[model samples]
Target: MAPVVTGVIDAHVHLWNRATDPQPWIDPTTMAAIDRDFTPGDLERMLDSAGVDAAVVVQASNSAAETRRLLAHPSPRIAGVVGWTDLTADVAAQLDGLDPASRRRLVGIRHLVHIDPDPDWLARPDVGRALDQLGARDLGFDLVVRWWQLPLAATVVAAHPGVRFVVDHLGGIAESDDEAGWEAGWEAGLRELACRPNTFAKISGLAGLVNGGDGARLRRVVDVALDAFGPERLMYGSDWPLAELGAGAVAWRRAVDELVGELSPAERQSIMSGAASVLYGLGG
Candidate 1:
């Protein structure tokens, strides 16, 4: 496979040292592909093989401890860290307690709002206050919500104009036999969030969203996202080990590169690296 997108800053990735890290989300009985230890060393080969020079390590668990571990990783491949923190608690104290070194590495914060039973979990006053704290630190925030939560998420985004919000997985895109109506609704909600200048979209996680590995539908989703968010506000991400569950790591990048190749080379490169770099403050 030819590597068209060079030095791609994979905007979303998760790395866990299973021997020491507690991955409450992984079930060994089911997810055999990624149930074992996956360290920075393991990811290095994949990045090297796929022509990805740098990446942002996103949180898998809700523990700040896991975020600390990722920050401490010695891989130069990790350009920034979107680690986790308890958004409901005193976010300022948590930011203050972080060592100078980890603080510099902390580019953003995220909570697994996708699994939360409450649809309006992000609408709480306490949660909004904590997210505002992130802006005070000049940090971005990753919104891990499903399509069902888009309306609530838009409300939160509207409330905080300072925080840069990165929306993941084409806003939780999923495939169905009759996706025409769903796609229209999804695009409408996505447009509402995209209407906010602070919000950007990560064009990753398509593998988990589609069935039968249809490239055409994946390309269509990319096109829709590009139309909604535009290339400047969109970024590429593999979702890594999680991607191995659906599209193998290499295939995901290749497929995304194929769909995005339609854009000018400068535009493709911008989505692959420049957008993520500026969004995460990963300076040249």
Candidate 2:
């Protein structure tokens, strides 16, 4: 049975068209899994099954046109989109091209920060300057850094308090025993980052990271995040298409429910929907 309507809004999902642009993942084995198109129709079907009201479509590629295409699609369920624009680009001109109506759905900006986790990536003077420009535009910055990269990410994030910084996947802790290499640093950095009012954390995507959709390990990580970010700064997201790697959207929904089973009703609501609406400026 579909989960009951808890008034949740899935805060992160990706919709792709394989015909238009093939994702950069070129491994013959893994690429085949997510190489197809997922449109508004696919999203609606999944939302109906999960009983979610709306969602924020985050960018999978650093393509402004892709964001424009998704925004043009007519759907009330698509309350917002975290489109990608090269942070290093001429952001003002690039942002001006996005129609106001379409851009209204754009709540945040994200570039694949983890692609190269040079500890100095976030701390560079040039990168810090770009992030400052993004803050001037009043858009949130999605921090997609890896686990070992959290310490520097915290330093990078600290440089821009004017913008909201969302730490995706609880700092992208790999859902495996190998996570130990950076576990302590990740946890410590999370705690420090949480101390920043501008920072928020997305509690999403554990099933895809760990083997066999490990629910127990995910719960433990969730506990740590909950402690750091608290209910107000935390939000739920279904990393969709990527989530399909571990299990389908349905499996992710189940895992999230089980992981948060012990939370208070209000806490659950905040994590599931409330925080996302407020932070992303999505309508209730």
- Cα-based lDDT for every prediction: 0.82, 0.78
**Local accuracy of candidate 1 as per-residue lDDT tens digits, 168-207:** 9888864574645676667777889999999999988775
Task: Please report, as a residue range, the 10-residue window in candidate 1 with the lowest summed lDDT.
Answer: 1-10
C-alpha lDDT (0 to 100) for residue 199 of candidate 1: 92
Per-residue lDDT tens digits for candidate 2, residues 1-284, read 01122367898888988677467674558756666788989898888887788788888777778878877778777878888876666777888888876677778888877884454666777667778887876678888887877878787777788878899888888656765656677788899899899999998766564437465667778889999999889998888867777766767777778777788999888888877876776642
- Among residues 3 or more apart in sequence or in different chains, the pairs in candidate 2 whose N, CA or C atoms overlap within 3 Å are none
Clashing pairs in 1: none
Once fitted onto the true fold, the runs of candidate 2 whose alpha carbons sit more than 4 angstroms away are 1-6, 26-28, 117-119, 209-213
Residue-level error in angstroms, candidate 2, position 270: 0.6
